[model samples]
Target: MTVPKGKLIIIGGAVDMGSNISAQENILQPNYIKFFEQGILKRIITESAHHEASKVEVITTASQIPELVSTEYISAFNHLGVNHINILDIRTREDASNPEYLQRIRKADVVMFSGGDQLRLSAIFGGTEFLQILKQRYQKDNFVIAGTSAGAAAAATHMIYRGSSNEALIKGHVQITAGLGFIDSVFVDTHFVQRGRIGRLLYAVASNPGILGIGLGEDAGLLITEGSMMEAIGSGLIILVDGRNMVETNIYDVEIGAPVSIENLKVHVMSIYDKYDLLQHKLLIKKVVKVENGVFIKADK
Candidate 1:
């Protein structure tokens, strides 16, 4: 398999873009401020080859409130000192084929997908020239593809389109479909911890042990390089469910709507600074120590 030259930043839901809450609420909740002000968005800019000069294209195709999301993202990026940003409000199949949008995509350094419905992303850009250009750029250039919520979920080869957290363990409860195919053999689910989505992600992996399941929590994300090396970022948790060592599972035999059973399914929880290798299926953690100056520093494990 050929390794990709670009980067993929997959973020869980609830990334505050300075539009979700009022100034008073933001002042009261400083944590939300950190997420946008000095967190994931900042990292996205830093990872770009040209940093602030990178031409960013915000694809609001997945969002229902495209205008609101576009305005919010523009504010967020401007706050981070990134001025070259454009919002691509591609809402229809024909819009996905627009020559102007295609030209803009060719020159863009970073492409960001906002949170909304994953199916819209797949149905709209699945086989279009637009997706083809994005894939080519990802494979050959130092491009960056960042997505939050539904955008994150649709970055993988297989996507979980429908699944109820309460009944996720039941056979056939979780629905799977082809996604944008930016990454393979991986299934990503957003709003993980906040919505209790582990059951659905587990079921996805249990059904297909070859596929790795990643559950991303709100305000959390992973910065992936070479399409394999993943560095955990943001302030929330990230769950990895590995079913490769599974000894037994009754998902196939169990009747629909019945609870399925699985044994020896391995799970790993990660936080900021943690690293996970998608190809090797290994986890590496970073240890930190606080100094006398009341500052934290990395320490050798």
Candidate 2:
């Protein structure tokens, strides 16, 4: 398989785009706005080929309130000194085929999908000319594709369309579907730690151990380069569920709605700056060094 030259950034939910908080609160607490602005969004701009000069296209097709999402993204990008930004308000399959929209996608250096219903993304853009062009650019050019929340969930080949967090461990609770296919053999779940979504992601991987499961915590993200090297980013944690070495699992024997049993499922927890090799299934930890009174202290191995 040919390696993709482009990059993919998948972020967890609840990225502060300055739209959630009131203007009064933002004025009073300036640091609150700076947190996300200086963090993930800044990283997105920096990863692009031209940085601030890159033309970014924000697709809000999955969102119910596309106008609001569009406004928030526009404001956020503008704050980061990105003037070349366009919001693609594609709601229907017909909209996905618009000549103008397709032309804009061709010119964009970076494409971002906002948080919403992942199903909408797959349903609307599937088998469309727009998706074809996007895939082609990602394969041939150094394009950047970024998504958060539902957008993140849909970036993989397999997606969890429906699954309640509380009863996720129950058999048949998690529903899997075909996604955008930007990444293969991986299932992504967002708002991981906050929502207690490990069970669902585990179920996903247990159903198919060949596929690696990634659980992204809120405000956390993975910067995937060449579709193999994944570098963790942001403030929260990243969970990797590897089921390749499973000793036993009764998932196939268990009936629907029954509690399944599994043994020896391997899991890895990662933090900011940590790296994971997707193709090799290896983990590379970053060493932490502390300074104390002009003395440098290395963390114990």
Candidate 3:
């Protein structure tokens, strides 16, 4: 019996009202994918991956991670075979940084974080018990971990919260920082191209050229596993920025709001039906949209 370990699905648009029904089934077997796609079932699936889950637990570090941002979440659980549901509402500043609450994060087969303020999530659970629990679950049980927007932002070792391409690189330095270490050595940014976050991820890469920068468009996500591999799932695309190839950077010397010069940075854009080797830092699958991680975004309004 080769039990299924788990997979992480990070997506861009189609976050609301079944916009992402196609990819939600990534957590289930292909034979059972259809059941998980139904609107009602997905909601159950989302809620099940929590406290009630004898084998899973859902963690919400952000206040905005409600049904409004993800209507199908709770229902996703409805269709899923997994059984568990626990909502972690550590929204306040005090609660986010609380170590005790973070400790309870361990009892889960799937530790998921809802999207909101990447900074707030990081500040609350970055170095606390919440993070440790996730690491253990993922490494030991191959728990299915997932996040979007701010939630996705907090998955990487180096995380970007807020930054403006209009502003100078140094001006936005403190605006971003390290997020939860779900995926180490990668700087993650949400609302990516649509929000003009390339500069921010570039800045993170410039700070240290060893890390890879991953930008997830709204309604898009990347399913990453331990074998140094990741699958692209969702409507949008996933951008992989390899800072290791960076050669020149005048980020610090460049004036705020002025153009900065950088080169030798490698970039790969991936779309649906694609895969990336996180450990190899290369694209193992075809680039659906020419691997640009296209910059298109559908408004929430």
Q: Locate the minimum summed-lDDT window of 10 residues in model 1.
A: 22-31
Give lDDT tens digits, candidate 2, residues 1-301: 8899999999886665655531111122322322454567788899998999999999988777777677778888898999999999999999999999999999999999988789999999888999989888888898999998888999998999899999998999999999998999899999899789999999988899989999998778999999899988776789999999988889999899999888888999987678999889999887658745432233433
Off by over 4 Å in 3: 1-8, 13-56, 65-72, 79-83, 92-105, 168-174, 255-258, 287-301
**Clashes found in each candidate (C-alpha, N, C closer than 3 A):** 0, 0, 42
Model 1 lDDT per residue over 159-255, tens place: 9999999999998879999999999988999989978999999999999999989999887899999989998887788999999999999998989
lDDT of 2 at 214: 97
Q: What TM-score would candidate 3 get against the native?
A: 0.72
**What is the Cα-based TM-score of model 1?**
0.93
lDDT of 3: 0.58
TM-scores of all predicted structures: 0.93, 0.91, 0.72
Ranking by TM-score: 1, 2, 3
lDDT of each: 0.87, 0.85, 0.58
